[model samples]
Target: MKTNIKILALFLICSISAFAQSSKDAETVLQLSKDKWQWMADKNVDKLKDLFDAKAKFVHMSGTWKTDEELEIIKTGSIWYKEAKVHDSAIEVSGKTAIVWNRITLIAMVRGNEAKTEFTVTEVYQKQKKDWKMLALTFSSVRDTHQIKK
Candidate 1:
């Protein structure tokens, strides 16, 4: 009976260690979501592309999710963002995958008109080759725009 108890205790310790490792990996993947906002704020599309998987699908505020090819086209339009921030409201880490739900606040200019918008954004990332790559992203507008006097 003593030997059996020892084996059981060893098994429990191994299981808990595995769980902890998985949780850490998941949290690391989720951090990539925040890096995306910094990339956009910098208006360097190249950085965004580096983080994105080649097969990434990005859904715009227009209600249409574009494939990688389409997203690349949009990136070419010259993004000029004045302000962008991501508030990490919740983060859940699972093994080999992570889902980040956050609020994205941004001020941008389209045709020289300041556009301020908030969105509830969810981003999924995968671990590949020791790096986290954004696999998918979807967002919907949360709050409407209010004019800022110049």
Candidate 2:
């Protein structure tokens, strides 16, 4: 009976430790996603390049493109991401992949014109060699009142 109790206690401790680690990973990915928005607004392609996977894809209302094209657009100010005011966000982490959904008011300069729009942005990130790389980003136009279900 005592041995059984010891085994149960050990199992619970291990389970709790795993949960804590998962929570920490989720928070880290969440912060990375938020930083990405700021990097886009600042046009910090250096940081973005490191964060984006080589085969990363981006989907915008205007069109869809790959990593190099997206970086070029940002570098040339073709579509300057001025600001993203995130209203709500949720993240799910499964194994090495994390998906984040953010509802935001994005102010951008597109083709020399300023536009503000509400969108739900979905970002997918994968852990590779101790670093998280953004694999995909998709923007969907939505109403201001749209909420991200937790």
Candidate 3:
């Protein structure tokens, strides 16, 4: 009976440790996603370039594009991200991959015109080496009241 109790206690400790690590990873990814929005608004392509994976894909209402094209769009002011007001966000971390969902109201300048839209943005990140790199970003139009299920 004592041996069984010890085994159970050890198992609980290991499970708690794993859960704590996953929670930490989720928070890290969430912060990264928030920083990415600010970088986009500032048109800081240098920081974005490092965060985006080499083959990263971005999906927008207008069209879909790859990392280089997306960077070029931001750099050239084709689609200037003015601000992203994040209403809600949720992050899930599993092993080396993390997925974040954010409901945001984005104000942007598109082709010389200012536009505001509500969207749910899904971002996927993968741990590469010691850093996390964004692999995919997709924006879906949604109602202002849309909520991310926790």
What are the lDDT scores of the predictions, listed in order?
Answer: 0.68, 0.95, 0.97
Which one wins by lDDT: 1 or 2? Answer: 2
In model 2, which range of ten residues has the least summed lDDT? Answer: 17-26
- Say which candidate scores most in lDDT: 3
- Models 1 onward score TM values of 0.76, 0.95, 0.96
RMSD of 1: 5.9
Candidate 2: tens digits of C-alpha lDDT, residues 69-132 = 9999998999999999999999988888999999999999999999999999999999998999
Candidate 1 residue lDDT tens string, 1-150: 999999999999999998888778766765667666666666556777778788878776654554455344446533345666765446666666777777768777555578787877778888787887788888677863422221
Worst-scoring 10-residue span by lDDT in model 3: 21-30
- Residues 64-124 of candidate 3: C-alpha lDDT, one tens digit per residue: 9999999999999999999999999998898999999999999999999999999999999
Clashes of 1: 0
How do these models rank on TM-score, best leading? 3, 2, 1
